[model samples]
Target: MMLAIDFVVVAVIFVAAVGAMSCKNLVSSVLLGGLASLVASYLFLRMGAPDVAMTEAAIGAALTTVIFLVATRRTQEVEE
Candidate 1:
């Protein structure tokens, strides 16, 4: 059961990473990156690293995402 859960989380992280890379829109990429970070945090928690998980969630997921979104809003989107 735990192994299955780990596999699922790993899969999600890979998907989110791919999605972020393929995204042309900055906002979408930022959101996907945050999703990946959150998933990584969850995995960290499951692996018995609560400190690392909290750091990842607070800095990687939340703070970084907000920063990216703000930066995205300040810039103009270019159409391809």
Candidate 2:
């Protein structure tokens, strides 16, 4: 059961990473990146690293996502 859960989490993380990379829009990429970080935090918690998980959630997911969104908003998109 635990192994299955681990596999699922890892799969989710991988998918999220790919989604982030493949996203054409900056906002979508940032959101996907945040999701990936959130999943990684969950994985850390499951691996018995509560401190690292908390940091990843707070900094990796929340703070970094917000920063990217703000930066994205400040920049203009280029048209092809």
Candidate 3:
């Protein structure tokens, strides 16, 4: 049911966040972060808070990703 789906979303988000943290490539890490944020938004929506979910989707997924990419541009590329 909804709770089961919520659990899956949380698991996926956890994995994505961990992958984002461990990634060597800044661009991929940024994308994973956005993915994690999107999963979080979905979780929020499932929890019956559409307003909060919308904000998280717009700000966490979109704006935060943009900021991370912009910040990445100012930093040195990740070394293997």
Candidate 4:
């Protein structure tokens, strides 16, 4: 059951990452990237790595989102 849960979590992380990378809009992409990081952190916790999960959640999700938002604010958003 734990393995199954891990698998599902990993799947969600993968989907979220793909969405982030492929998204055209800067805001949507950053949001999805942060979501992927958050999901990945949960997966790390399930795998018995709480410390790594915490770091991932902080750096990958929170810090990264802040940086991306700052960068986005400094430039014009490109349209596809």
Candidate 5:
């Protein structure tokens, strides 16, 4: 049962990764990246590393995503 759940989480992560790479919108891509990180945290928790999972969720998914989004927001797009 756990193995099957792990496989599903892995699949979701893979899909989110690919979606993040291929996305045209910066916000959507960032969101997908966050989703992948969040799912990875769940995987870590399932693998018996609660500390690692919490760190991933707090830093990777939340902090990184917020930073990227804020960076993008502060940028000015120039059309040539």
Candidate 6:
């Protein structure tokens, strides 16, 4: 059961990561990246590394996503 859950979570994370990379929209890409990080944190917790999981969730998922989103927002889009 646990292994099956792990496989599902890994698949989700992989999809999110690929979506993040392939997305043309900046905001969507950032959100996808954050989703991947969040899933990774859950995987870490499931593997019995709670401290690493917390750090990954806080920094990799939350802080980094916010920072990237803010940075993307601050940039003006190029108009043709």
Q: TM-scores across all candidates?
A: 0.91, 0.92, 0.86, 0.88, 0.92, 0.93
Give one clash count per candidate, in the order shown: 0, 0, 0, 0, 0, 0
Residues 1-80 of candidate 2 have per-residue lDDT tens digits of 98999999999999999999999987899998999999999999999999999999999998999988877776755321
**Residue runs of model 1 more than 4 Å from their true location after superposition:** 77-80
How many clashes would you count in candidate 4? Answer: 0
lDDT value, candidate 4, whole model: 0.89
Q: What's the residue-level lDDT of 42 in candidate 5?
A: 98
* lDDT for position 20 in model 1: 100
**How would you encode candidate 6's per-residue C-alpha lDDT over 1-80 as one tens digit per residue?**
99999999999999999999999998999999999999999999999999999999999998999999878766744331
Query: Candidate 5, which ten residues in sequence have the lowest lDDT sum?
Result: 71-80
Q: Give the winner by TM-score: 3 or 6.
A: 6
Local accuracy of candidate 1 as per-residue lDDT tens digits, 1-80: 99999999999999999999999987899999999999999999999999999999999999999988877766654421
Model 3: how far is 43 from its true place, Å? Answer: 0.5
* Cα-based lDDT at residue 48, candidate 6: 99
lDDT-sorted candidate list, best first: 5, 1, 6, 2, 3, 4
- Candidate with top lDDT is 5
Candidate 5 or 4, higher TM-score:
5
Please report the TM-score between candidate 3 and the true structure.
0.86
Clashing pairs in 1: none
lDDT score for residue 19 of model 4: 91
lDDT tens readout by residue for model 5, 1-80: 98999999999999999999999998999999999999999999999999999999999998999999888877844321
